[model samples]
Target: MIIERKQYKLLEKIIFEKLVIQAPFKIPNPMPDEACFLYMLEGQINYKTENQNVSVPQNESVLLKCGNYFSQIKNDKSATLHQIIIVHFHPKILKSIYSSDLPEIFKKPSFIDDKIDLSHINNDFLIQKYIENLMFYFDNPTLVNDDILILKFKEIILLLCQTKNASTIQQILSQLFSPTSFTFKEIIENNLYSNFSLVEFANLANLSLSSFKREFKKNYSDTPANYIRNKKLEKSTELLALSEERITDIAFDCGFKNLANFSHLFNAKYNCSPSLYRLNLKDK
Candidate 1:
């Protein structure tokens, strides 16, 4: 439950927001087109992603790439209530802030290898002070104006550029402006390895669930679940036969969160467990 909420906007777009909520509640980032910088004021949060979930602890922060993410606020006795500060980075706003000359960081590719949609920033004094200043605006809302808010938002961008994860941050921030367009099949193929829910896959494909299903069937001739499952299973077989990776690791790599489920599917598909399959392949 949200006990209180406050926000500041620029040209009707949410620039900064502060939220105080009761713990043990699920929260999803509703904004799909813009990335956000989330600072943990009171408690921690875990950003659910395709590959690995990223945790933002108290006094720390995370920069998420533009996408739908689900999060949870655990009921930790040490911190019962959760307070969060969100700074939104919209592409239109960025272009406006930089005027005709956009920053080079937004143009250059970071060539980041991890490809994780979220980047974690370690403890930084500048960001901590910046959060404190944001709290001031939250406390003194009446004094804020659009110009000041824009300046404050720009200040955050400058500070972010100075952070250790500047390249990765730039990489995420860059995607907002020089956005890449992927086809429905391309999008599905790119993220086929990870374990994403059908709804999340729909969001990635920029379609409603029903529309996504219809389009998927038209393009792939199969339901999303069956296609993704068979694809993941196929990848597991290739890895099991070729790589020295452990069965457990292969399960995770193939998007099965549990070894038992991977084993069951592997047995049903290949007529043997992953371990045995690898052993039999070695003998051949």
Candidate 2:
């Protein structure tokens, strides 16, 4: 399956893309440098981030804060195709929009969350119409006007602001204008429990791989891989001792992908397998 997109670069910092992804494939964390409003148009896909793993169904929408993430679309041998419309706005574009002569509502700060689910908003029809209008411009690029595109962007923001999820929409705008740089610790805390790779973590921290390693050593006094592995194993042990959750669930929740791997790592770290460790705690 291929990842296809018809992208329209309306401004230096604004882009409209219609993405079509065939099933049975995974798009390894294509982290954008800007925040995005993602509207699901067709089938479902499993969207995974450092902080979330969600199934975004068709017609639902999500506002993704600018950060590291990856997505997977599996067919399960079915014939369903996944499609999405994305409005990606760079920080500069956000700044331009925020600085314009708009009302006080537009001046409100856009908050940044790892993920903001917009499916609960009952304004899907209205938002879909706006997308259709944008498509019209996309289809007729010759007729595209910068002033009109800016207005369209503002219109969508205003429409979202009027929805029930107005607070989140406002935060999205507010956060866009004020992107906080995550510290090494903050990044680690946010993603330690996720199934993200070292490279993905580097991207999340906005650092090169070597720089991330250097910073990790400086802050944690341990290699990134070792620190994360130990932390996950510790978490797994705590969960095993404290909760009745299955070992497999504990493994997954602790960021380990498989039970065998988790058990091996756990045994190596604690001198006992996960199930045996749980039994030991129970016996005590």
**lDDT of each candidate versus the true structure:** 0.80, 0.69
The lowest-lDDT stretch of 10 consecutive residues in candidate 1 is: 70-79
* Model 2: pairs clashing at backbone N, Cα or C within 3 Å: 109-174, 110-171, 110-173, 110-174, 110-175, 111-171, 111-172, 111-175
Q: Please report the candidate that would top TM-score against the real structure.
A: 1
TM-score of each: 0.64, 0.63
Residue-wise C-alpha lDDT for candidate 2, range 1-284, written one tens digit per residue: 55676766654544677778766444433333456677778877656654566676777777665544444554454356788777776767766666656444435454444454222343377888888787787678788777877788778777777677777666554554555566668778867767778888888778899999999999999999999999999888789988997777678667776779898898888898888888988889
Q: Poorest 10 consecutive residues of model 2 by lDDT?
A: 114-123
CA lDDT, candidate 1, residue 222: 97
33 Cα displacement, candidate 2 (Å) = 9.1
Clashes (candidate 2): 8
After best superposition, candidate 2 residue 11: deviation in angstroms?
5.3
